[model samples]
Target chain A: MSTQSTRLAARFMVAPSVIVLFIWMIVPLAMTAYFSFRLYRLLSPDRSGWVGFNNYVWFFNSPDFWLALTNTLLLVGGVLIITVILGVLIALLLDQPVKGQGVLRILVIAPFFVMPPVAASIWENLFMHPQNGLFAAIARGFGAQPILFLESYPMPSVIAIVAWEWLPFATLILLTAMQSLSSEQLEAAEMDGASALSRFRYIILPHLTRAITVVILIQTIFLLGIFGEIYTTTQGGPGSASTTLPYMIFKQAIVAKDIGRAAAGGIIAVILANIVAYFLMRSIGKHLDA
Target chain B: MARAASPRRRLLTTLAAWFVALLIFFPVLWMILTSFKTEASAVASPPELLGASWTLENYVEVWSRSDYPRFFWNSVVISVGSTLLGLAIAIPSAWAMAFVPGKRTKDLLMWMLSTKMMPAVAVMIPIYLLFQQLGLFDTKIGLILALMLMNLPIIIWMLYTYFKEIPGEILEAARMDGAGMWSEIAYVLTPMALPGIASTMLLNIILAWNEAFWTIVLTTTKAAPLSAFIASFSAPQGLFYAKLSAASAMAIMPILILGWFSQKQLVRGLTFGAVK
Candidate 1:
C-alpha cells in the first residue's frame, strides 16, 4: 500500500502539525528554561540579570513551595481517588438493566460539560455557602450547626468541587468501557452459579483495568493543573491552604511579578509532569503493533 | 440470550441508580431551579424546591445588565473556529500516519499525545509574555490560535484513531481503481470517515468550549469567553444569587445538550481510543 510518492507525501503531510507542535513545545519551553536562570522581575522591568539558579533556590526555599507541592499532590491524589472510585460504582450501576438509562446517563454526564467557573460558583454560593448553601440549609433543618466548608476545610472542599467536575468524565469513559464488555461472559458465569461478587472480581475487574489506568493517567494530567476551580472558590486562601503548584506559579508570576521565580516553578511543574508523562507515554505506546 | 434481571431487582437498581445520579447532578439542577427564583427566595434556608414563584426575571436581568451575547459569541467562535481549524490540519496528518506506516509512527503518535500531558501552567510565563508582546493578548484571534494550538494533539489523535479503524483494505481498493489521489480521498475517504470526523469535531468543540485556564488567562475582556464571564462572580457582589444561577445556567446549557448527544465519542477521544 505504500508507494514512493505516497511515502514522500506522508512526511510532507505530517510536517505542518509536527512543526507547529514542535515550536509550541520547544520555543516557550526554551524561553522558560532560559528565563528560569535569569533574574527577571516584572516590577523592575530593566533589572534583568543572570541569577544562576537563584530563582530556583528562592522558589525551593520559600515556604509556599513545599506547601504548594504537597497541596498539589494531595489535590491530584484526592480528586483521583474520589472520582475514580465513585465513577466505577456509578458505571457499574449504569451498566445494569436499569430503567430510564438514557436520562440517567445524561444527568450523570451533565457536570462534565459545565465550565469550571460555573461549577465553582454554583458550589460556592449555592452548595458550600456557610449561611445559605444547600448543605447549610440541610444542616439547619436537622437542628445542627451549619458548617463552613471552604473556610475550615479548604483543601477537601476544593477537592470536592474538582472531583464533581471530573467524576462525570471518569464515569462516562468507564461506562462506555463497561458497555463494551461481553455480556455473554458475565451470563456464562451466572449460568454456572457464580456469585455476583465472584463474577465482578474475576471478570469485570480484570476487564476494567485498562480503562481505569487510562482514567488515572488522563485525569492526572488535568488534575495536576487544578487552577480555575481553586481560583474562583478558594483563591488558594485561608493562608495558602489550598494553594496547588499551578496556582502558586500563577501568583508568583502574575500577582508577585516574579517572572524568574515563576519560571523556576514552571520548570518544576514541567519536570513533575514529565515524570508522570514518562509512564503514560510508555503505556500507550507499549501496545501499538506498527 | 442473557438472563433478564428480576422485576424487583430492576426496580431496586433503578431506584438506587437514579438516586445517585440525581445526587451527583443536584448542583447543576439546583442552579437551574434557583435561576427561576427571586433574589429573596434563592438563598432561603430549607432550600425551596418547588415552593418559590418561578420567574424569568433573573434571566431577563442577566441578559440586559451584562454582555451575555458577546461572551456567548466568543465561546462559539473560539470553540467552533478552533475545532474547524484543528480538523483541517488533523485530517490530512491523521490520514498520512494511519494509512502509511513508518517505523516511528507509533513513537510520533505517543509524542503527540504526551503534549496533552504538559500542564498549561508549565509554559504560562512565556506564552503570556509572547501574547502580550505580539499584541495578541485579550483578543478573539489570539484565543482562537492559543486554544487551537492547545488542543491540536487531541484533534490529531482522535482523527488518527477514527481513521485507523476504517480498514486499510477500503483505501487499497480505491487505489486499485482508476481513481487518482484527490478523488480517492474526496469520495472514498471523506464519505466513509465523515461520522468519525464529525464526532471528533463535536468532542473537541466541547473541550474547547469548557476550557477555562487559557480562556481566562489569555483574555481579559474582548476575548473573555463564558469561563471568564462566570469567574467574574467570584468577587463579592450584593444579592447576585439568582443572577449567578441564571448566568451559570446560560453558560452550561448549550454544551450540556451537545455533550449529552456526543458522549460516546468523548469516551473514545479522552481514552486515546484505548477504551472504545
Candidate 2:
C-alpha cells in the first residue's frame, strides 16, 4: 500500500475520537457565544430576546467583573510565584543525598494526590479554623486572638492552599529536570573554577528554563479554573471577596441561574484562557520540536 | 566540586526542608488527628496534640450516619470505569497519531488539549440541561460518561507521549508478520507501553475520584462519590469540626493510600516530558 493510503487509514482510525472532541468543544463554545449576545436570564422566561453585546456590556461595566479578574490574576500569579520558588528549594534539598529520601519524596508529593475538596475541608476544619485550628491553637499558646485565614485574607489563603498543592507538582518536575542535568557540564564549570552561584546562574538555570516554563504554563492552565478550593474554603464569601472568574460563572449559572450572563462569563473565560494557552503552546511547541 | 558544608549548615538546611515538608503535610495530619477527637475536644483551645482522649467514636458515627461504603463503591466504579473507557478510546487514537505522519496531527492534539483548558463552569449549564433532557442526571452511567469524556484529553495526551517513545519499527515488524491491528496493539504495543498506560490509568483514576464540581452538581444521593460525600458535611451550622474532619479523613484515606503506594508513578506521569 502507498504511504498516502496508509496515512489515510490511520486518519480514519483516529477520526471518531477527534470528531467527538471537536463537537464537544465547538458546540458549548458556540452556545456560549450565542448566549453572550442574547438577553437571557434564568429567572425571567420572557427576557429571552435578542440583545447583542448587552451581556458583555454589563459584564465589562460591572465592578464585580474587574474584581473577579484581578482576583483571578492574583491567584494565578501568587500560586506560580510561591510554587516555583518553593519547588526549586525543595527540589534542591531532595536532590541532595538525604536519609529516608523515598519517604521524604512521598511526603512531598502526598498533597498533590489529595482531592481538592478534601484538602480545602481539612484546611477549613482542622488547620485554619479560627477557634480550634492548629494555627489558632499555636496563636492561643502565644496569648494571641485567633485570626481567620479565609475570612480576613481569603484570596491569599486560597492562593497559599493552591500553592501548597501545586508545589509538589512543580518540585517533581524540577527535580526530574535537575536529575537529568549533564554532570559533565557541571564538572567542566567546576574545573574552570566557577563558583556554585555562577554554575547555577550560568548553567543550571538555563538548563531549567524549559522545565520551569512548562511548570508555569501547565500550572497556569489549571490555576485559572481553580474552583473547588475556593468554593469549599470561602464559597466566594465575605461579600464576593474571593470570587474568581470560575466562581463568578458558577454563581451566575448555578446560583443565579442566569444562563446568558453565565455563558458570557464562560466566553470571556475561554478567551482569557486561550490567550495564555496560545503563548504557552507556542513556546512549548517550539521547544518540543527542537 | 567537593566543598563540604559545615555540620551546622547541613543541619539547618535539612531542618528547614523537613519543617516545610511538615508544614505542607500538617493539614492532613491534623485532619487525621481531629477525626479521633470529640467535637468539643476538636475545638479546644491550645489544642491537645496527644492529651485529647482519643476515640474512634467519630469514625463509627460518620460511618453509620452516611452510606460511606456505597459512596466508596460508587467512587471506585466511576473512577475505574471512566479510566478504562478512556484508555480503550485513547490508546488507538494516540497510536495512530504517534505512528502516522499527518499534517493536522499536531494541531488536532493541541485542539484536544485546549478543550481541557476550557473551564467546566463554562459548559455546566448546557451539560446540565442536556443531562436533564436525556434523564442522565444523578446516574452512575451519566457520571461515568462525563468523567470519561472529561479525562479523555489527558489520557490521549499521556498515551501519545508514551507511544511516541516506542520505535515505529517494532510495530511495523508486527504488521509485516501478518499480525492484525488488534494483535499489534494487544500483543506488542500494550506490553511495551504498559508502564505509561499504568501511570495514565492511575492518574485518571485519581482525577476522577477527586472530581467534585461535576459530581456534586450532577449527582445527589444515589451516585455521589466521596467528593460529594465530603461536601455534604459542610452545613450552615456554626461548626461541626470533628464530624467534618472525620468525613474529610474518610474521603481522603483511600486515595491517599493509593497515592502513597504509587508515588513514583504519579511523579513520573506528572513530569512526563517536562524533564526531557
Candidate 3:
C-alpha cells in the first residue's frame, strides 16, 4: 500500500543521497564545461578570458594529445585483449578438479588486490630496473642484455604490469561464471561421444560469452581511468611515451598549470568514457535485475 | 565431471596449476622476500632469493624513518570513515528504493551507476580547484568525503541489491506492529541485512584504502594515505629495494587479507551485479 505518509517517508529517505550525488555530478561537470571555454591557468590567476573553442583547439592541436590518445587506446585495448584471453584459459584451468584449488585461487587472485602504485613500483624497480631488476638478472643469466622495459619499451611494459594486475580479476569473474554453468550439460555431451574440444566449443564457449562481455566492459571502464601505475612508473614520460588520458590531464592542470587545456582534455575523456559506458550500461544493465 | 582421474593425471594437473599460480604470484612473493633482505643484498645482481641474510632492520627502519604511523592512521580513518559514511547515506535510500513503489526507481539507480562511469579525471580540475576554495585539500575529512562520494554509488547499488532480496513481508509485519522507520531498520532490516552490510563495508574499505589517484593528487604529506606514502617511495628511494618492499608489504598486508575474505563480494560488487 503506497499510502501518502509512506510515500512521503520514502521520499525523505532517498532525498539526502540523491541530493548529494546530484550536486556532486552536476556541479563539477558544469564547472568543467564552464572552464573548457574560459582560459584559466592556475599560475596566472589574473589572466581569465572568455576565448570560446580556443582551448579545445589548442588541446586538439597539441602533439602530446595525439600521443596520449594512442597510448590510452593501446593500454586499454592491450590490457583487454591479454586479460580476456588469459582469463578464459585460466578460468578453464581453475575450473578443473585440481588439488589445493583454494590455495591456487588465493595465489592467482592476490595481485588484483595489490594497490596500483605498489604493483607498479614493484615492477619498475624490483623487476624492471635496468641493471639490478630480476628481469635483468634473468637476461644476464641467459647471456643477453637486459631489455630496458620502462625506458625503451614503456608501452608494452606498462601493458604487462597493468595486465598482470587485471588478469586475476578477469580470471576470478570468468571462473565464477564458469562455475555457474551446469555440469550436467557437459556430462550429457560427454556421454554422447563428444570430444573435449567439441564440448567446450558448443557448451563452454557459449556459456562464457556473457561473462566475457562483462569482463570487457568492467575492465574497459577501469582501464579508462588508470593513473597510479603510470604515475609511479613512468610519470607518463620518457616524454609522453606512456601517457594515458587521465595522467595527461593531471600533468596539464598540476604541472603545466594550463587549466583551459586540462579542462578541454577532461571533456574529451568524459566523452570517450561515456561512449564505452553507454554500451556497457546498455548491455550489462539488463542483467542487473534484483 | 567429478569422476576420479588417474593419479598421474591428477598430479600432473596439480603441478601445472601450482606452477601457473606461483608464476602469477611471484611478484608479490618476491616483494615479501625482498623486504627481509639487506639493501646491498637486495640490489645484488643475480637477485638474492634465499642466499641473502634476512633481518628485521628494514621493517624497523621503514617504521622509524618516515611517518608510517600517520599514513597508517590516515588510511584507517579515511577507509573506515568513508565506508561508514557511505553506509549511513546509502542504507535508507537503498531500503526505500528496494521496498517502496516508484516508477522511477530503476532509472534513478541507473543514473547513480552512470555517475560512477564519469571518469574521475574529467572532473579533476573542477574538484581540485573547488577543494582549494573550500579548504578541503589535503585534509583527512576532505579525503573521507571525496572517497565516500566516489564510492557511494556502488555502496548504494550493492545495499539496494541486498535490500531487494529481503522479503517485504517482514518489514511490513514490523510496520504492522507499530515499528516506525528508525525501529524498523534498527530491529528488522539491520539484523536481516547485516551480512550484506558487513561485506559492503569490507569491500568499500578495501577500495578506499587502495585508492591512489585522488589520494596522490590531493595530498602531499599531511593527509596522504598509504597510497601516497608508498608513492613517495617511487622516487629515488625506490632504488632501495628492501625498504620499498618493506613499506609496501606493511601498506598492502591489511587490505590483502581483507581482500581474500571478500573475493566473492569482489565479483558481485565490482561487476555492478551484472554477472552474479
Candidate 4:
C-alpha cells in the first residue's frame, strides 16, 4: 500500500487541489499585505506611494473601527446565543414522537434555505416596515403606534433576521446529535428516579455540547463577515448602528475607495479570523483523532 | 425513550411541534401569500392574509418588467458551474486522501479546512483590484472561480468524508486484477461513490446558490445572480410589495427545494465532518 509508484500517483492526484487552494489563499493575501503598506486611493491612482504603517494607524485610529468591532462581536454573540438556545429547544421538541415528523422538520428547516438577501428584504420590507409592514398592521390592529424596528433597533433587527436564517442549521445539527443518543440511557436514568429536568441537564445537554460547539464555531465563521443582511435591511445605517467589521472594511474599500486603509482593515480581519480558526481547528483536530 | 404515552400526551406533543414549526415558517408563508396579492391589497390595513384578492399579475410583471430571467439564468450558471468545477478538483484529491494515506494527509485536510476560515473580506480588496485589473469585474467566470475557491474546502471535506467510507480493498482488488488506475476510478470507484458524489454536488449547489457575499460584490448586472438581483430591491420604492414578494419567492423556491433534499448531507458538509 505504501509503494513508491502508488505514492507518486497519489501526490500527482492531490497536487491540483492543494496547489489551487494555496494560490487562492496566498496570492490575494500577499496582494492585500502589499497594498496595505502603500497609500493608494481608488479615485486617485497617480498619487500612490509607500507609507509604512500609516494605513494601519488610520484604520485603527478611527472611532468607527471600535464601533465596528463591538458590533461584530455583538452580532456573533447575539446570533450564537439565540440560535443555540432555540436550536436546542426546537431540536429536542422535534426529536419527540410527533406525528407528521417529516413535514414538521421540513417546515422548521425552510428558513436556512432562503437566500440572505431575500431573507433580509422579506423581513425588512414585509415585516419591519413601519408604515405598511405586517408588524405595523398588527400593531395598528391593537390601536398602538407602530414601532420602526430597523430605525429604532438596527442591531437587534439584523440579529433577529440572521437568527431566523441560521436557527434551522443549529436545529438540524443538534437534532442529528440528539438522535444518536441511546434511548436506553434515558430510560435507565428514569428507572434510577431521574426527573425529566435532570435527565435533560445530564444526558441530553451533555450529548449536545459537541454539536453546540460545532454550530457556534461554524456560524461564527460566517457571521463575522455578514454583509447581505445588513446591506439589504439597514445599509449599516441610522449612522453606522449595524456596521460590523467586514461591512466597515467593505465601505472603506468600495464606498470610500481608500484602497490602502481598506487593505489594512482586510489584514486585521484575517488576523481576527485566524484566532477563531485556531480554536476551531483544535476542536476538529481532536474530533478527527477520536 | 419511546415510552407508551397516553393519547392526550401524544396529541399535545404533536400540537406543540406543529405550532413551533408553523411559527418558524410563517415569514416564508407570508412572503408567498403576499406575492399573490395586488399591490394595494398587499399593504392593506390590518394586513389581509387570506382575504386579499389573489392574482398572478405580480408574477407576470416580475417576469416581464425586470431582468428576472437573466438573473435566474445567471444564478443557475454560476452555482452549477462552480459546484461542477469544485467537484472536478475535489474528487481526485479526496480519492487520493481516502485511498492512499500519507503522513501529511491529516495535516493537509486541516490546512484545507483552515483556508475556509479566512474571511472573504480579507481578500475582497485585493480580489476586487485583481478582478478590475484583469477585466473580470461583473463577469460570471470571475465569480465562478472565486466561489469555487471559497467553497473548495467544504467540497473537499465533504467528498473526503464520503470517500473514506469507501473500502480501499476494492481498489486494491482492482489493482490485483491488473486494472489501470484510471479504469479502477472510472469503472469501479465511480459506481461505488456515485451516491456520495451526487450528495456532494447537491449540497454544493445549494451553498453556491445562496452564497451572498462574493456573488453580490463581484457582479453588478450582466452576471448578477438572484442574490444580487434581490438585493437591488433594498431601496425604498412605492407600490413594490407584490413585486418584491414575487421576486423573493422565485429566488428562494428552487434552492429551498434542493436544500430540503440535502439536509442530511448539509450538517456534515458545513461542519467539515466535525458533526455527524
Ten contiguous residues with the weakest lDDT in model 4 chain B:
B231-240
lDDT (CA) per prediction: 0.88, 0.81, 0.89, 0.89
Predictions in order: chain A TM-score: 0.94, 0.94, 0.96, 0.96
- DockQ of each two-chain model: 0.73, 0.56, 0.74, 0.80
- Across A243-272, the per-residue lDDT of candidate 4 in tens digits comes to 999998899999999999999999999998
Residue range with the least summed lDDT across 10 consecutive positions in model 1 chain A:
A281-290
User: Tens digit of lDDT per residue, candidate 3, span A1-290?
Assistant: 66888888999999999999987777998899889999898788998999999999987898989999899999999999999999988888888889998899999999999999999988998999978889999999999999999989999999999999999999999999999998888988888999989988999998888788888887887889999998888888898899988998999899999998889989999998878777776877565453
Error of 2 at B141 (Å): 1.6
**Superposition error at A91 for model 1 (Å):** 1.6
> In model 4, which runs have C-alpha deviations exceeding 4 angstroms?
A279-290, B235-238
**Per-residue accuracy of model 3 over B1-276 as CA lDDT, tens digit each:** 354568998888888889899999999999999999999898897877668989999999989887888999999999999999999999889989988859999999988988888989988888888888899999999999999999999999998888888998997888899988788878998899999999899999999999998899889899999998887675363457898899899989998899999999999888877777
Rank all candidate structures by their DockQ, best first, as comma-separated numbers. Answer: 4, 3, 1, 2
Winner on TM-score (2 vs 3): 3
Error of 3 at B52 (Å): 0.9
The sequence of per-residue lDDT tens digits that candidate 1 reaches over residues A1-290 is: 78899999999989899988988877898899999999899899988889898999998898988999999989888999999899999999989888898999899989999989899999999988888788988999899998999999999999989999999999988888788789888888999999989998999888888788888888998898878898888889888898989999999999998999999999999999988777765775454332
Residue A85's lDDT within candidate 3 is: 92
lDDT score of model 1? 0.88
Provide i-RMS per model in Å. Answer: 1.7, 2.5, 1.4, 1.3
Better candidate number, 1 or 4, judged by TM-score: 4
- Calculate candidate 2's fnat: 0.58
